[model samples]
Target: MTVFVLVSGLFTGPHVWQETAARLTAAGCEVRAVPLGGLGRIDGLDGLDGLDGLDGLDGKVSDPGAVTDLESHISDVVAVIDSVGGARGEEIVLVGHDYGIHPVLGAADRRARSVARIVYLDSGMPQDGVPALAAVPDQLLREQVMLLAAEAGKGAAAELPPPSREEWRLWGSVAGVPDEALDRLTALAEPQPLGTLLQPLRLTGAVTSVPFAGVLCTGSGSSIALVQARVDFGEPAFQALADPRVTFFELSTGHWPMLSSPAELVRTLLDAAAGRGHRLTPANAAGPPAHLRPFPLDVPEAPVERIGRVDLHLPSGDRPRPAVVLVHGGPVPAEARPTPREWPILTGYARYAAGRGMVGVTLDHRLHDVTDYGRAAADVVDAVERVRADPRVDADRIALWFFSGSGPLTASWLAAPPSWLRCLAANYPIMAPLPAWGRLGSAFHPAEAIAHAGDLPVVLVRAGLEVAEIAATVEEFLDAAKEHGANIEVVDVPDGHHTFETVDPTDATREAVRRAVRTVLGHLTA
Candidate 1:
């Protein structure tokens, strides 16, 4: 007797959930796909004819020019909930997809007593005071979208028009979607009210008491493993995701799961409501956290000097020596204990470089999330500038080595490497963001930037057992590097994982590390 209420994302309406709702009805579940206000009225589905009882929903806004904001949409969802006995003690499983989640949360906040569970379908956990525009995957496009919305809102009825067919990729991944479905999606897509994206979602903190579920769409870029990795980094926000009340399920489809895999989405929804989805393990549940694990290599420690936020491991010599800047990877939690520069693996490599008569440098950067790549890159630039100016380091023959998630930082250097830059290296790096990151354009894609790396010696230490998404990015970079004839060398660790130095400590991994170090040093000394 559980009633399920569905809410669709931006530029979409209840019609988008028609196929999924039909399947859910066949499964003996009562389904109500709430047609949100401000998304315009659905006339009819051309290819999908004879679907009865679709038009003339109670709260749908018929006039496209009517002024509507987030409150109107929230009220629309609340109306549907109250209609279906939600206000009369009936338990309801409320589901929200993409921008639809905003209104769903707002409504759930008001009707917390009746909501059995709140489901986040392929969307970020929207926080209080943060608008939906802030959830746009690409950082650069987020700014532009907000700026355009602000400028357009001065008119009578401010609305941001839906993206064209070709422009849909900018909003979310369109993979696995059929041509007809895309056509329907574009045709029925409505102009979203600016208030929906610009106005912040206000919550009364009542919904936190309700159970939650997450339906992650892997084809669009997020997965259980990635979420776990972020949680392992001790991000306070992500820690809440590991709560036992929050369940998770992954769908191997695009952003619009209801369109690409309706039956599968329906099945997963049933499973989620039953609390049968995967439960994330708390950080340090098995043993000590990955960062605190011992280093794989036993290199002799070198004299270390801390200057501001940068650490310099100097070799035994007064003469100026070639330097190697080790840039650590992250979207690491800002409050992670010991910090990235202090991690044993980073320090191990820094000392190893110092033992080989080079000044090894490491610095903490503010790469707190995927969107902070711009800030992290600037911090790296500043650190490198300071290292080059050091009297104890050779300014003309410096090397830059990146690790893990910091891989995308190589784009700027590869596109226009300085004459004094000797070599570039990356160890198990993420060359590109996952598809779920939306079209980041070309700003952070090293796979595309490698085309411009003319004659710069590049060393890549690849992990054979790396995560599938990360491994795919490496292959993409390699292919692009080959096509452009860039000077690149590969040092493969066949049995190693992404953070192989500590996670998969073996002789093979240690040797791979040594080989990569030797290659970079050769270029620095050449």
Candidate 2:
């Protein structure tokens, strides 16, 4: 059988996969590293972003946000897929490494009908909606991207990493990279649109059922934990591996396996492309909750009132409603205005609590302003107490529905849950934000939440098709929930992804949200 696997080529060129491809060939398999986008000898007659003289520009201009270039690069990937084994076979395997993951995964999402296998090599978060630049971690290069995002509202993105001496050194100076390629890389290393980076890589169609795999180099364990002075993801390397389509395997080597250990890397690629199933387990497992069923809450829409110059929605109804508060994600903050833009959760979920018949209070809490988890948690606890104090609400029936930044807030509450507050319904909550570099899941920590959840009804929703960072967080949190005996329900939704699902709304993802909310709250009678 002719098996194909697409391999990610980080900042380097497609030639980077030559060694691995060679090895695969020796094993009677045809391997070709899909030279992506503007890389290699590819000619862009029209040029990216209307730039001229790009007819011979290589794919060196790596920017996540530039949708035009991403689309162009996508065209290239689509071409490669179409070209795969014209006469041989249609077994195509796709691998993405570093920035290459952007093109690799993006292409796969569009070309899943033709692709046989997909691989992410030392990749970053691959999501839908947000651009590649926004999704990429800051450590990939030296830049302040969040600041950029703030300037342009939600859709603004970072530009391509400018070709620099340091970057050149990182690639060319590396042991396996050749010195002669420096000039070529510099010549072709044009600045790409930063928009592509922030956009989430969406592949919901046949991709969900495709054989996706991640070739994680073992060295990442040492570096992810110790090198960055961050033991966050590295501590649970095995667990961090994501990609619903991926069948991850630890190829013991540096981040660039093709360069460091091509033969073994090729073997691993073959194993993955062959559709051979491997017994995979996450490294870190977040504990379980004490309760095993959803607690019924009397949820009612809490109206908005001026609280500290900000409108706050608290649970209000005729009966003493079992209350649940909405703790939302990290939003951009400004010193001049408390709530710069109305929190996303308000329209998405909080406003509808009244219709659901639960005493639900949606608070526009300070996300970026609060420095520490303790203070953040203390605020949530304060809100819980305030709602419980309300004469119209059932004090003992309070629960939490946290998302993004709320993960840490809920975790702190879980650490020392208030007697009156119920358990948590953590929806993609935050945990260890320090090391995650703003990527979802990895940044969302949940240990303290599990430890603190004292037998309250809990439901955890994580996108099963999320990248390593996001999926890892969800798995650990769910595991922790199960361990703690919390009445926990879990829904891993990858089959449902939408375009621009992050900032804006999409029908598929919106339905998924409804399912999560209804699933978690429906079980409990109001």
Candidate 3:
């Protein structure tokens, strides 16, 4: 007679809850898996079901905002509760993961009379009026997020960025959402509503009166590094639930548990449904998480500041090309050069650019000393000035190609962007300072660069999975340029992230990346 209503976390739909639901059902419990609005395949363009489903809804979709906002999600939870009515609602175990706690609790409050118990799978409890983002503990990411919000300023309500075509692809593989349903999920995904994130939650007494339990994943659920650990550890949430009213299970898994450990995960859910408090002790727990994706990091170079020199990695055919100042991330010196041939990626990008007859330059900026992204940006601007003053640079042919933070810094420096060297190519650019993700984008909110857009052409590239909830930042930057009547082109990279990479990226994926860069270059020449 009891039904179980399950809610998934951010960026996920009801489909992910299927395995657990099926397991619970086999144990004789009725189940209702509810999909959240922005992530599910049924609605919007950024969902997992397919892109076609959300295509017609593009331009009509709303933002996803931050995870703490409960008002919006209340409706998502209530819809399923309403459908189940009185009889089944009485026996429901309302469960949620990660950000799913908000809606699941909100729904139980609204439908208090019909609900049974609430379970959080390593998800933080959504305190009334408290924000979900406030719980994140990563210092660098938090710093970057605050900077983005401050930069966004009054534009907070504007559209967020959409995940690049590549990002969605990567997320599916990493999250175990399956490639077949990727396009639809991406199309259904929406820019989170900023106000919802900022708004305080005031739960009606009815919600807390319901029974509840929680399982917290102590590791990566709190930071990006932890999320990355999933590549090898799988979902860690299931390994830590130890309570009886709510069983706590800890697995050495990644954030996306269902994708990596569905079988053990299913058994746990079923045990909970059967009042068994299922937990994996020493013998039966899932194995360590495994991440097959490869992530690349740029080696630190010497610092450059004021009017001094820096090292930047721009692939323009020949290295040490005569007469070019370079810009780089962190502090790297000219002597700290990394052999291009050694890094297959740098090699590929370099070969492509040089084959197209582009000159190369590299530079570095002061970031280690500065405690904030804004100061770091100033360093980038100074480096560019140095490049301009140098007689070696063919000012007419200067093209700025960068990813992440450098994109906004370079774009901001242009005043009357010449059609040639004035061209801008950026991927996963830190164009907007996102409040929700804290300091993640603080170093280079594209809005800061808007002053110079009138002088040049700008293009933006976004990684699907890496941007995650902060996808809207890209849109705000593009909107500023279009507002100034500047020409702009936007490309969505499939299976892409902060860096230019795919999950086990194949030659085809590499070719796709190459074509994208070349297209941007060709457009500038045109």
Better of 1 and 2 by lDDT: 1
Model 3, runs deviating above 4 Å: 18-28, 37-69, 88-90, 138-159, 162-188, 216-244, 278-526
1 against 2, candidate with superior TM-score = 1
Give the residue spans of candidate 1 off by over 4 A. Answer: 46-51, 54-59, 62-66, 86-90, 439-443
- lDDT tens digits by residue: candidate 1, 108-206: 999887789988999988988888888888766677667777677675446667889987777777878899999989988987878888889999999
Q: Where does candidate 2 have its weakest 10-residue lDDT segment?
A: 287-296
Root-mean-square deviation of each candidate, in angstroms? 2.4, 15.3, 14.9
lDDT of 3 by residue, 1-526 (tens): 6677777765556655545555655666667766555544443323333222221223322254444245766676787777777652356677787667777777787888777777776565566667654444335533544665566686554223445546532222234435544454455455543333455556787875665554433222233232233222222332233223444455434445565566666665555555654332321232421122332322222222223444333333332322222233321122322321123343344344544544344444544311344565675556656655545444445566665544445544554454435567666665543322234343345665576666466666666665442355676766777777766776666666555542426554565566666665675455
Those runs of model 2 whose alpha carbons end farther than 4 Å from true positions after fitting are: 1-10, 41-68, 85-87, 139-159, 163-190, 198-204, 222-246, 281-526
User: What are the per-residue Cα lDDT tens digits for candidate 2 across 1-526?
Assistant: 4544443443445445555665666687655555554344334323322122221123444343334456666666676677664456557777777677677666777877777777766665455554565434334342444456466576553344545744543321232334444444455455444444555566565555566666555444212221111111232223233323446576555455666677777777778777653433332232211111112222343565554423345444566766657775553233312242244344335555556666656665555432434445556666766777776667777667776545665555566656655556765554444232422232225664576667656677665444344445556766777777766777555653211134223455566667767765664453
Candidate 2 lDDT at 474 equals 59
Better candidate number, 1 or 3, judged by TM-score: 1
What is the model-wide C-alpha lDDT for candidate 2? 0.52
Ranking by lDDT: 1, 2, 3
